[model samples]
Target: MYRSLLLGLAGNSAAEALALRYGMRLGASRFVAGTTLGEALAAVKALNGKGIAVTLDHLGEGIRHLDEADGYMGAYLSLLQAMNREAVNGNVSLKPTQMGLALDPVSALDRIRAIVREAELHSLFVRLDMENSPYTTATIELVRQLHREGFSRVGTVIQAYLYRSAVDVKRLTVERINLRLVKGAYKESSSIAFAKRDDVDSNFKRLIKIRLDSGVYTGIATHDETIIDWTRSYAHRRSIPRSAYEFQMLYGIRTPLQESLAREGYTVRCYVPYGERWYPYFVRRLAERPANAAFVLRNMGRRE
Candidate 1:
């Protein structure tokens, strides 16, 4: 119930505005790295030193203007350059809406194509983040287009909650594109998404197996220990190399688990999100785990 409520609030514009006003004081600092690129890069460097790879995300979405989209693209380009210069072991993940997919898809595609090419120059990968159902088809299609255009380093995510995901995974497998599987965080409709944890988990495991067997590099992005252990076991039984797939978790949510997996010789990537506009992303993180929410509640009365 609490998770559902927090997920619902993730889309509340008023709540987002209020939360932004309070900024880091809202206890977002625990989840969000910081509000600047430098802070985020520092965090990335620390993770890199610890043998953990990183996927840098500049957190803002639901863009409305071409200028806003252009800025995001520029920011990503700069980020990619910085990573190369700093020798950080990381790539990037971005939302299509943040690139103006809703306002003008052609523009968004152009922006993403440019970023993908830039990443190519830097020898990095780009992952297109899947938003809610409204953007699912578009996100998948965009990745397909990129692949056809020879941007093989490009990839995207699939949320297990959506019923269409199984099919989407198969279709994407044909393209031979890399993918990240996530248990979705969006507030989705019962008609379209699984409503129970058991259903989601079951589907998640199914998707993981499908992707693993598909013979592509897959990212299993889950904090659930059961899923993590199962993935480890499944890969071992199949004699899959550690390079065949990697484990991913959010930046601050499960530090110890991430490190342990890395120590165990698993390729682990941390989703490091940083930017001033972190309200929506932070709230979604809260919705994913009750313990994170409780931590925030305990510190609510205290100043950031």
Candidate 2:
């Protein structure tokens, strides 16, 4: 119930405005990296020092203008430059709409191709983040397009909640592409997505096993202990090398587990999102876990 409410409000302009005006003051910093690139880089460096790899995301989505998308492209270019210069141990993940998919798919493709080219130059990887259902097909096409063009460092995500994901995974596996398997966050409809948590979890585990067995580099993106243990046990039983797959978690969602995984000789990457347009992203994070809602609300009331 809370997840649906929060997701609805993610698209509410008035709610976004109010939240953006007060989110930092209301303790959003705990989840968000920071508003500036430098701050985010600092966080990246700190995490790297702890033996954790990173995938940086400069957050903004639902863009509608060409110039706005161009600006985000510039931001990513600058971010890539910084990552190379500062020796930051991380790559990047980006949203298609932030590159102008909503305005024009051709223009969006051109922009993303440029970014992928830049990543290739820097020997960095780019993960095209999966958004809500509307862009799912387009995102997959973008990944395939990049791959066909010889940009091997590019990849995309798959959401387990979607009914079509099993087929999608099977199709993608044929290409031997890198994939991040997530349980999904957006509030999708019952017609297209599994309405029950157990169903989603089951699909997620199944997808992970398929991807792992196929010899593709799979990112097991989850914070669930049961899933984590299952992944570890399955990989161990099958004699899969630790380098064959990695575990991923959001930046602030599971720090201890991330560190523990790293210490245990597993490659763990933290999805670190940073930028001023953090209201929507932060809200979704809260909705993904109800306990986050209570913690944030209690802190907000205490501050009051």
Candidate 3:
């Protein structure tokens, strides 16, 4: 049922209907910055003013077809150019399939190389976001190739909930890859992933300690207060300097926690996504928190 909601939002017309029906403002708050490049940049400026860094993500996944994938790659190249001209205090994140991975491996990797070269020219970073487990190996392969090409500015994500991520973390150290650790948001098989929340949290801290000790640039991406507290205690116990790593969170999800981390002098980056294609993104947020869905429903009547 939740997957259906996400798929529905990915459809442009369905997303429009849902947005209007829900009385949502739909101006790139959590889902995206905006459809226009100017709007996206303006949104970035606003966040930078608050001392919160941003990451530009062209909202998309699952290519329409090979031709469409090509078009998407062209658009990303243009976005990279704009990012260079804008020179904003943020980097770009991309999903491989969106760059043509689904069409063909060679096609996707080449396009990714183009984007990475663009980021390199501008001295920017590119974050390869991890999707479902099916794409994990392919994504890692692409990252490995890219890193071999000397793109330290490139990084990929891992889900701690995956029973195998502990080994993956060590593998990442082989390339000295920067990683964003998240509780696997996608539902997967218990054979491959931990369904219980406690187990996921435990693995998260364990991986955090190892990564910090390994001296890799790690991103602890979660809003769980307990994990945040544990991270603090662990860092303090090891007397690890604050520059060792940073905490990352989704925008519009944990305002208070983000601020608290910043006030304590920790580097906190808010994942700010912006684009007209925000429906799939918003639906995922709602599914993550049914209470948020209920809140939106309560305001439905006001929009009517």
The residue ranges of model 1 lying beyond 4 angstroms of the native Cα positions read none
**RMSD in Å for all candidates:** 1.2, 0.9, 2.6
- Per-residue lDDT over 1-304 for candidate 1, one digit per residue giving the tens place of the 0 to 100 score: 8878888887788998888877577578888899999999999999999999999999889877799999999999999999999999989999999999999999899999999999999999999999999999999999999988888989999999999999999888888889999999898999999999999999999999998888889999999999998988998898888888999999888899999989988999999999987988998888888898888877786764
Off by over 4 Å in 2: none
Q: How many residue pairs clash in each candidate?
A: 0, 0, 3
lDDT agreement of model 2 with the native: 0.92
Q: What Cα-based lDDT does every candidate model obtain?
A: 0.92, 0.92, 0.80
Best by TM-score: 2
**lDDT by residue (tens digit), candidate 3, 151-230:** 88899999998998999999998779989989867657789998777899899988998898988888899988889999
Against the true structure, candidate 2 reaches a TM-score of 0.98
lDDT preference between candidates 1 and 3, better one: 1
For model 1, the run of ten residues with the poorest summed lDDT: 295-304
Candidate 3, 212: how far from true, in Å? 0.8
